[model samples]
Target: MGELGEVPNQLQSFRVQDAKCYCCNHSHIHPHSGESLPCDRQLVYETFKKWWSAGAEEGSEQHLERFNTLVRQRVAPKVARGLGIALPFHYVVYMAVFCMVPWLSDFIALWAETRDHRAAVSMWSLRHFIAWGIVGVALLFALRMCVWLWKLGSRIEKRLDSRWCAVFIVAPLSFFGVCALWLPIGISLAATPEDNPLPVFLFIAAIAITALVWRAPKWQEPLPSKQPSPHVFQRKEDNATFSI
Candidate 1:
C-alpha cells in the first residue's frame, strides 16, 4: 500500500490500496499525484469536496440537497452514460465465450485421451465419472474467463472518450476476428455429423444465459454515490471556527 501523501488531497478520502481507475485503466494514482482512484470513487470524492468547500454545512437540509443536486447533475449521468455504452460489448463477449466453452472442454478431453489411451478407456467405462470431472473443471474455467473478459471490455470502454465511435470500429473487427479464428474449427467439426447439433445447443444456452444476466436486477440498478460522513464535515467546521 502507498502512503496517503502519494494521493491527491481531493481523492485521499476515497483511496483504496491497489485499486485501479476504470476510466483510465490505471492504478489509483491521480495524474498529478501519481496515486490512482477508481472512477466512481473519484467522482464521489470530488462531489463531496465541492459541496463542503462551497459552504454546504453538514447535517443541514441545504447540505443534503446540494450534495444530491451535485450528484444528479454531475455524477449519475456520466456513470449511467458510460455503463450504457459498455454493457453491450460485455454481453456480446460473455455470450461468445459461453458458446465456446463446450467446444473447449471437448478439445481438452480429446487431448487428455490422446496422451494416455487408458484415459480414453476410463472416459467410456465405469470410471466415466473422471471424464465428467474434467468437463466440470473446464466449465468453471470458461465461466471465470467470461467474467474477466466482460470486465476487460468495461475497462476498455471507460478509457475511450468517443465510445460510440470506438464501438462501431471495434465491434465489427472483433466479430470478424472471432469468426476467422473459429472458421477452421467449425469446418472440421462439421465433417463429423454427430457434432452438428452441439453447436446449436451451445448457441441457445449462451443466448439464454446472456439474457438472464442482462435482466438481472443488479445490472439495472444505478451505481451508488456514497455521501461523506457527517463527522468529517463537523470536524472541518470546528477547525474553521477555531481558526477564525
Candidate 2:
C-alpha cells in the first residue's frame, strides 16, 4: 500500500458549493460521494494521466470538471481512507503490487527448475552451448517484442474509452501473452528440429493482435453528446463483507 501514499492528517471538511458527485460512467446522474471516503482511485487516475500526458487539455475547466467527477465517484475514496481529506481529489498512480504475488511465486518455481537443469548441463558440450545461445537469443527477442507491445498498447489505449480499450486491446494482448508464454515450452521440446514452427506462429499471432488493436476504432459511432445518467454507489465502510 506504500504506492497508495500516506494518508493526510487534515480533518475532513465540507465544500461551500453544493455540487454533488455524478457516477464516473454516467455524467448527469448524481451519486452519494461524501468527503473522506473512497480513497482508492488508482485506475481512474492512471487513465486520466495517460490522456493528460498525451497532450489532452486536462487543465481546461471542462475536462477538469469531468475528471473531478470521475475521481470522486470512482477513485478517491480508497486513497482517502484514514486521511482527513476533501472530495474531488486528484491522483494518477494505480494499484499494481497485488500482481506481484502470483508472478513472484511462479518465478521462484521456474528458477528452481532452471537451476536443476543447469546442474545437469556440461559447459564443454557443443550441444549445450548451442541450446543456451538459441534460448538466450529467443528470450531477448521475446522480451523486446513484449516491451514494444506494451508501449504500443499504452499509446493506443489513450485514444479509446476504458471499456473499448479493454475490448480491443486488453483482451487480445492477454491471449497473445498466454500464447507467447506457453509456446516457449513447445519451442524447447522442438529444439532438436532444425525449424521450430511454434515460434513463427506465435510471432505472427502477436503481430496480428497488435495490428488489430492499433487499427480498431477507439470508440463506436459518436452519438449526441448529452449528459449521462449517474448511478449511486453504496459505501462498504464497515467491512461487513469479507473479500479476498
Candidate 3:
C-alpha cells in the first residue's frame, strides 16, 4: 500500500477544502470522491502557513488575531448583533416614557381640578407637584438601573451563555409591565387616597394584561416526541455495513 502517514494529512487538507469558499464565501461546492473536500491543496497549506507565521502556534499577537478573525468570519453576525444591541438602552428610553406616564396622569388631574376653579387652594397643586416630583426621581433611578442592566447584559453576552437571553430580554420586559401597572395604581391611590373608582378599574386592567403577557408563551412551545425503543437495531452477520 501507499505510505502510512500520508492519509491523515491528506484528509486534513480535504477538510479545509470542504469548508465554504474563503474568497467568495459560498457553500455550494462539492468535495471530491474519497476526499473530505475538493479544492487546491496548496491554498489550504498556505492559509495555515500564513496563520502560523503570524504567530498562531505560541503566546504571540498573530495567534489572537487569527482566532478572532476565524470567529468573526464563521460565527453568525446576528448573534453578535443581538449581544451588541443592548436592549436595555432601548428600554431605558421607553422607561423614560413610562416614568413620565405618572406625571401625565398628574397633569390631567390638575387640568380637571383647575377647569372649574380659577383660584384653587395651593395645597392641592403642591401635593400633586410633590407626588410627580417623587415619581420623576424614582424613574430617574430606574433609568440608571436600566443603564446598569444594559452594561451587565453586555458582560453576560461576552460570556456566551443562555442566561443572557433571559435576563436581558425577558426580565426587563416583565419589569416594564409590572411598573406600568403598579406606578399608576400607587399614584392614583396616593393622589385620591380613597374615593376614585376609575383609577382602580384602570389598575386592574393593567395588572390583567401583565399577567396574560407573562404566561401566554408557555402554551405556544411544542412538546418533544417519545424516544424510540432499544430493540429497533438488530445486527446482521451477512449484511453488515463496514467503515473503511
Residue 230 of candidate 2: its Cα lDDT?
44
TM-score of 1: 0.26
Question: Worst 10-residue stretch by lDDT in candidate 1?
Answer: 235-244
Could you give candidate 2's per-residue lDDT for residues 53-161 as a string of tens digits? 5465544333334554554544444445422221111210112223233445544454445543342232213232333333333333344344445545555655563
Per-prediction TM-score, please? 0.26, 0.22, 0.28
Candidate 1 has an lDDT of 0.42
Over the stretch 1-244, how does candidate 1's per-residue lDDT look in tens digits?
A: 0121122222323312123334444444455777645555446445655756556455444544455446545665455445434335455556655656666666566556754445434333322232233333334334433443444455455667555655565566555644443343345334534324443444344445545544544322244344543332322211111110
What digit string (tens of lDDT, one per residue) describes model 3 on residues 59-118? 333432343344434442333333333234456557666857755775667757674432
User: Model 3, residue 179: what's the lDDT?
Assistant: 77
Count of steric clashes across candidates, in order: 6, 14, 0
Candidate order, lDDT descending: 3, 1, 2
Q: Could you tell which candidate, 1 or 2, scores higher by lDDT?
A: 1
lDDT of 3: 0.43
Winning candidate number (lDDT): 3
